[model samples]
Target: MNIIEDLRSRGLINQMTDDEGLEQHLNKEQVALYCGFDPTADSLHIGHLLPILMLKRFQEAGHRPIALVGGGTGLIGDPSGRSEERQLNEESVVQGWVSNIEDQLSKFIDFTDDDKGAKVVNNYDWLSQMSVIDLLRDVGKYFSVNYMLAKDSVESRIENGISYTEFTYMLLQSLDFLRLNQKENVTLQIGGSDQWGNITAGLELIRRTSQEGEDIKAYGLTVPLITKADGSKFGKTAGGAIWLDEKKTSPYEFYQFWVNADDRDVLKFLKSFTFLPLEEIEELKKEVEERPEQRTAQRRLAEEMTKMVHGEEALNQAKRITHALFKGDVKQLTKDEVEVGFKDVPTYKLEESEKGLVDLLVEASISSSKRQAREDIQNGAIYINDERQQDLKYVINADDQIDEAFTIIRRGKKKYFLIRHM
Candidate 1:
């Protein structure tokens, strides 16, 4: 199937400007399309994946994908989906985020110099050079105040008092499209549904500034804003946003996020996020219908996402941690895996080399008291490294530690505590 058809099948196409014409244009030649990512944070998160993957989809279809890091526009934050103005960051901070985001985007898009190889561009290069007078004379003149006000982005903010800096964000974005179209022969700009106004504004700028009968063919497309069936936000957990950077969110946690996808959302996530064949996904859909308790589809989704974002090694490590935890065989995990798997569990630092298992349980609050600890052990309710330790006098020695760093203590089936051997 063609790129547009594939995207539509995945429910990735939310809105397309002239869908018929854009499809024809894509089929005719190697169209260079771009999606701009504003460096609002030092790392891109799960929310940023759709647009980045959309670019990849086009590149796979023999088109050039441009990953535009909005070094210039990030400094002047886009107010497309906010209720209030965004706090502008220092130029140095934004530049650092720009570099970090570029590194993250590199993981997904192939930048090898070939016909369909992707290109990464920073708009700060040209936007920084243009003077205010030049912007007013060349780009601003083409946009009337009424025309700007009529846009959803501006209209929504009129009541909230948008700053002139933010109000003109559309114009700055428009300049990007026009500049790329002229210099790089870019014909399409893609973003999330929230960016529809800005994308179309850019298209308008390209048309207005073009020579009469120049055949300006710029178009815009947007992926839908992801929502959960439960009405909770996507890309969020109680901990916070699921970041792409492994340092921010470990591969284990990232894997868990997709692995725990809601029954209603897992199929949709599989379609949009993974490049798995549609036929394979259909089979998985049947698996979901026949036996969701197995969570086969969720596991596949997690494996695909974790492997794509983190390497195969990290994915293996995550799976090891997951399996070990589920099987209550955490002793099988390495020191690093232990740390990741039990990161949120209650923990106690053991300064002493060893201690009686009963006393350790009392000290770590795993049981209510010494009396309770002894009862739990005798009742076969207390476990050390998943091994039932009924001996009240049993000591938690170095052998109990996983890699001489941590000991997993379980009072029952699921409640776990971590003992750190200092």
Candidate 2:
């Protein structure tokens, strides 16, 4: 199957300018395509996954893919999907974020000496050096205020406000496409559904700016805005964004995010995220219906995605940590496993001169007050080292240390605390 058909079958195609024309263009060989990512944060969240995956698909099909970082556009935020004008970030801040994002993107796409190896570009390289007079005469002449105002991105913000900087964003983005087309032969631009207006603007710019009979053509394609079956936003938990960086989000948490996918959304997620063959996916769907409790589909989904972002070693560690935590088998866990599992739990420190279990629990805020801590201990709602410590007078000394430095404290069934001995 062609790349477009593969994207359609995988549920990745949300919108496209013209599939027939695009497919014809791709069949000609070594077509250059690109997708832009704004460096709005230090790390990309799950929301950035689909477009990046689409770029990977194109590269696998022997097409050249350009991953454009929006260092310039990020300074003037893309107002396409926002209801309000964005608070522009500082130049230094945006530059730092751009560098970090570029590093993270490298983990996903290969940049070696393969024939169709990917390339990275930053819009700031070109956009920052252009002057207002040159921009208005050369690029801005093609766009009209009426056309810009007509877009849903601008129209939605009219009731509140839209800044001049943001309103002119499309012009700058279109120029990026024009520059790439001339410099790199980039013909197709892919992005999220919200970027439809900007993508089409670029395509139009390429058409209008080309010399007579240049025969250059451009296309725009977009992927669906990922959302949960229950209509909540994706890539977010109580802990905030599910980052691609391991330091920001541990492998175990990332695995759990996929493993806990709602029964209704699992199949759809598998298609969009994983590169599993259609036949294998169909078989898994059947297994899901026939034996829902087995959760074979969710486990496979987690394994594939975790290994993709983190390595196989990290995936194995995450799996081991998951099993150990669920079974209360802490003794079997390594120091790294303990750190990953309990990273978010509240922690307290004992100076080797401090008092007992009650004091530690109160200090850690695992209990509301000292009286409450005493009550919890008496009622067997407290555990240390996975063992119930029911006595209020149980003074915790150096003897209570696990691995000679740490204590795992639990209040009730869910709340956990870590106490470190100095």
Candidate 3:
């Protein structure tokens, strides 16, 4: 299938300017396309994955993908999809964020300096070079206040109010497109749905700035915003946004996020996020219907996502943690796996070499008192590392520790506490 058809099959094309012309343009030669990611945060979240993956998809189709970091415009902030003005960051902070985002983008797209090699550029390189007078006389002259106000990004913010800095963000972004087109021969710009207005504005600037009869072919495309079947926002959990950085969101947490995807949303996620062929995804769809209890589809999605973001070893560790937790057999897990798996669980430190199970439980706050701890042991309500320990005199020693570092204690079926051996 053609690249457009492949994107269509995956339901990725949300809004494309001149679909026919753009498809023809992509087919003619190695199209150089670009997408802009603003450094609003230190790490890109799962919310940013669609566009980044879109760039990867294009690259796989023999196109050159330019990952543009909005180091300049990020300082101003885009008002699209916002209720209030964004808090501006220090130049040094934004630059640091820019470098971090560039590194994250490099992991997803190859930039090996080949025909289809990707490129990472920062708008700061050009936007910082232009003077306010030059911007007004050159790019700003083409966009009237009326024209800017009509844009949804500005129009929606009229009641709440918009800043002059943010209001003019489109001009800065448009200048980026025009500059890329002039310098890099980039013809297409893709982003999330919120960027349509800014993207079209860029195309407008490109058209106006081109000399007569130049036959400008710049285009804009936006991917739809991801939503959950339950109506809550996607990429969000009780812990907060699911970041691509493992430090921000551990591989186990990331794996669990996708593994716990709602049954209603799993198929759509597979299509949008995975490079798996349609045939394989179709088979998984059947599995979801026939054996929902197995959660085969969800597991596949988790494996693919974890392996892609954190690599094979991390994925294996995540799976090991997940399996050990599920089976209530955490004895085989390494110390690192235990740490990643039970990261959010309450923990207590064992100060002594050996302590009675009841004393340990009371000391760790796992039980309200020694009396309760003995009662819990007698009633078969407590377990040490998934092993039922009804012996009130049983001592939690080095044998109870996994990797000689931590012990898993369960008060009941689900409530768990981590015990760190000193």
Candidate 4:
């Protein structure tokens, strides 16, 4: 299938300007497209996945994808999805975040000089040198105040008060598109549905600012904003944002996030996120309908997505931890695996002064009181090193340690504790 058809089949195309004309243009030659990402945080979360995946599809379809780091725009937050004005970040903080985001994006695209290879651009280079007079006279005149105020982004914050800095955000963004179009010949801009207004503004600027009869053309496209079936925000868990960086989010947790996708959203997520062939996805859907208990579709989704973000070694480690945890076989896990897999579980150090199992359980917060601790041990509700410790008299000496330093403690099926020998 062609690029547009591929995007349509995968449900990635939510809104576009003149899809037929764009397809015809793509059929004649490779297109130059871009998507801008603001450096709002040091790491990108799962919410950034849709746009990045769309860029990947574009590259696969023999188009050049430019990943634009919003070093300039990030200083002035985009108010598209927010309910209120955002707290503006410091320039240094935003720059640091921009560096981090650029690094993360590099992993997802090819940056070689080959045709259709991805490229990275920073708007800060040009934006920082722009003077106020030039900006107001040259770019501001093209956008009217009435047109800017009518946008949902500006309209929603009317009562709460949108700052002048943010009010001028669209003009700056439009400048980026104009600059890119002039320099890189980038003809298409893509983003989440919320960016439709800004993207169209950029296209309008490109059209009006170019010399008369210059024949410069640009297009805008957007994908649906990802949301959970339950109406909660996507890319968040109890721990926090599911970061693309493995350090921020372990591979196992990242894999689990996709594996635990709601049944209603999995197919849609697969279409939007993965590059799996339509036929293969259709087969997986049938399998999901026939025997979802096996979770074959979920596993494949987890595997492909995990590998894409974390690489093969990390994916394997995640799978290993998943199997070990589910089978109650912690011994198979490596030292690093144990550290990462149980990082959030409470930990306590067992000093030589601690005399018995009761002291250990109480110290680890495994029980509320000494009496409860003793009762739990006697009732076979406590385990040390995955073995039942029914005897209240049992002492947790250094001899009962794993790796000569630690022991795994459990008060029940779910409550876990890690004890270190000091």
Best prediction by TM-score: 3
Residue-level lDDT of model 1, residues 1-422, one tens digit each, is 89999999999999999989999999888899999999999999999999999988888888899999999999998989888999999999999999999999999998877544688999999999999999999999999999999888889999979999999999999999999898888999999999999999999999888899788799999999999999999999999999999999999999999999998999899999999998999999999999999999999999999999999999999999989988878878989889888889999999999899888888899998999988999999988899888898899898898988999998888899999999
The predicted structure with the larger lDDT, 2 or 3, is: 3
**Candidate 3 or 1, higher lDDT:** 3
TM-score list, all predictions: 0.97, 0.93, 0.98, 0.96
Please list the residue runs of candidate 2 whose C-alpha ends up more than 4 Å from where it truly belongs after superposition: 113-116, 353-355, 367-379, 391-399
- What are the per-residue Cα lDDT tens digits for candidate 3 across 177-196? 99999888999999999999
Q: How far out, in Å, is residue 116 in model 1? A: 6.9
Global lDDT of model 2: 0.87
Candidate 1 regions exceeding 4 Å error are 113-116
How does candidate 3 score on lDDT? 0.93
Ranking by lDDT: 3, 1, 2, 4
Best by lDDT: 3
Worst 10 residues of 2 by lDDT: 108-117
Error of 1 at 172 (Å): 1.1
Give the per-residue lDDT digits (tens) of candidate 4, residues 1-422: 89888888887888999888788878879888999999988999889989988888888888899999999899888989788777889999999998899888888887777544679888988999989999999899999999999988889888889889888899999999999898888999999999988998999899898888787668999998877899877899898899998989999999999999877788888888888888999999998899988888889899999999999999999999889778777766766887777889998866683458887778778899999998999888997767788997888776676666667888889888887677
Worst 10 residues of 4 by lDDT: 397-406
Root-mean-square deviation of candidate 4: 1.7
The worst-scoring run of ten residues by lDDT in candidate 3 lies at 110-119
What is the lDDT, from 0 to 100, of the residue 56 in candidate 1? Answer: 88
Residue pairs with backbone overlap in model 1: none
